[model samples]
Target chain A: METQIDKLEQNKKSKEKKTQPEKEELKGTFAAVLIVGGIILVGWLGVFGLFLERA
Target chain B: MHLHRYEKIWLMLGAGGLALFIVLLCVNAFAMGMAPPSNMEMIDPEKVMETPPFDKPGLKQVGDKEYDAYMTAFAFGFSPTKMEVPAGSTINFHVTSPDVVHGFQIPETNINFMVLPGHISSATHTFDKPGEYLILCNEYCGAGHQVMATTIIVK
Candidate 1:
């Protein structure tokens, strides 16, 4: 039972170590996603605003 | 399928954005009445002129300041030739084509529709300012397409 608990704690620590690098890498990906989404939102709103102005 | 944590988060955000767009479209179309113009009213293209209302393409007062304008979009030009409405009056324009597909558009107003042969297209606009509102054919019909335009005099 003691060996099993020790194995579980080591597994959790390794998981945290692996995720630390992944989290840092995904920060740039998240920024890029937000930039792309912002462009699309701006374009859509531009057209919608033109429609309303013509209305 | 197994997905990474960031992948799941981005996927959810993308889906949420799409859902928000759909909800905005619904609200704008149903609540704000910004939907595109469409009417399923069909007629015989050949007999359009001989038809009841199309025979006399003009306006009929429907309410205090609302008028039903029956207009025809012909090959080279629009019928009736002249249309005059008072400022602040609302005109519900019911238009159609007999020869070919034409376009119905009023500048500075949200009254643009396709005048398809045998199909009736309608759009409404209120002329609050007294001026000449030009209606032009935005679709290419033939050589005379450029001249296929008229004016609505609001006085």
Candidate 2:
């Protein structure tokens, strides 16, 4: 009976594990990408603004 | 592939940004007519001086406040030697090169174009402020390229 109880507990833990993703360390990747993209967008907009002002 | 959630967001953002740039460029270039200076009129390089319009390299009033300035860019100098415009006058500059390539640029204005041997390049600018504006050759044509400049007196 104890063995059966332990098997049921193990089954429950495994089901919880199935719902979670494996740990992948992406340290500062998202922030770095956003900063770079922001820089490019800002620079492009600045140049476009200058063109419009001059044109 | 199992992409991370933030990765997917940034990827979509990047694609959207690129698409935005292309759309803006197309709209400004086609719809708004803000394309670069391009005068498609071609002439015989050998007969640039003999050309009817270019032969008379000077300013001619087109509208009440607009002038069509036909000018030639030669080996080391520009024809007509001098020009003067009234304040708030808009000058449409049609420039051509007889010898080699040269740059026609007016400082503090949006009139900058290349004068090619067989082609005419044109740009327009309004002289709103009364001052002496310098039109200089920005290309390295020869030893006298630095001296290839003229003044447009705006009164």
Candidate 3:
């Protein structure tokens, strides 16, 4: 009875490990997209500001 | 917490404005690299043309004689390959282009100017001390632009 219980517990832990890598990758991608998008938006604004001041 | 409709719109706009600022800073920095240093006080090309006074203000006198260095901006290379100047001495540089327009820059010393065809460009630099400096062509003339660079040696 004890042996069967130990086997069931080990199987559950292994299943949890599989999802960890996928979760980490998704988090990394989200952070990168946010930073790049922020940079592009700022560049456009500066050019516009220069033109406005000149006008 | 639940937010009202007006608050949500303001929050989105704030985030977007912050992002726009960062992008502009990067683009401006990139553009600055293409040309010479914009600050006039640092690298003033106009100071190069006139003759030195008896008071010897900004000019450096080496061995009681002025060295005339010829830097040609031609199809492929700069003629002398290396320039040497004494420490605490003001050296005059005569830059000319036998071909198209090219940019001359010494990034370490913040020396940048343009050499146009059918005209002579001149600049003077006072070496406060001694070290090696680099000179580069900032403009994208054509092929071989990448290798269009030389060095200035100060003793």
lDDT (tens digit, per residue) of candidate 1 on B10-88 = 8898999999999988998899887556678899999999997999999999999899999999979998888898899
lDDT score of model 1?
0.88
**Candidates sorted by DockQ, best first:** 1, 2, 3
Candidate 3 residue pairs in clash (backbone atoms < 3 Å): A39-B23, A41-B20, A42-B20, A42-B21, A42-B24, A43-B23, A43-B24, B60-B90
iRMS per model in Å: 3.2, 3.0, 14.0
The per-model lDDT (C-alpha) reads 0.88, 0.86, 0.61
Give every candidate's TM-score on chain A. 0.56, 0.56, 0.52
Predicted candidate 2 versus true structure: per-residue lDDT over B1-155, tens digit per residue: 67878878988998898898799789988998775666678999899888889988999999998999999988788888999889999998888988999999887777788889998887888788899988899999998998999889999
Better of 2 and 3 by TM-score: 2
Clashing pairs in 2: none
Query: How many residue pairs clash (N, CA or C atoms closer than 3 angstroms) in each of the candidate models, in the order given?
Result: 0, 0, 8
DockQ of each: 0.28, 0.25, 0.02
Q: Model 1, DockQ value?
A: 0.28
Docking quality category of candidate 2 according to DockQ thresholds: acceptable
Off by over 4 Å in 1: A1-24, B29-35
lDDT of 3 by residue, B1-155 (tens): 65544445556766777787668667766964432322232212233223223112222344543655556665566656767766666656656665677888766453567876645566655666588877788887789888888877778
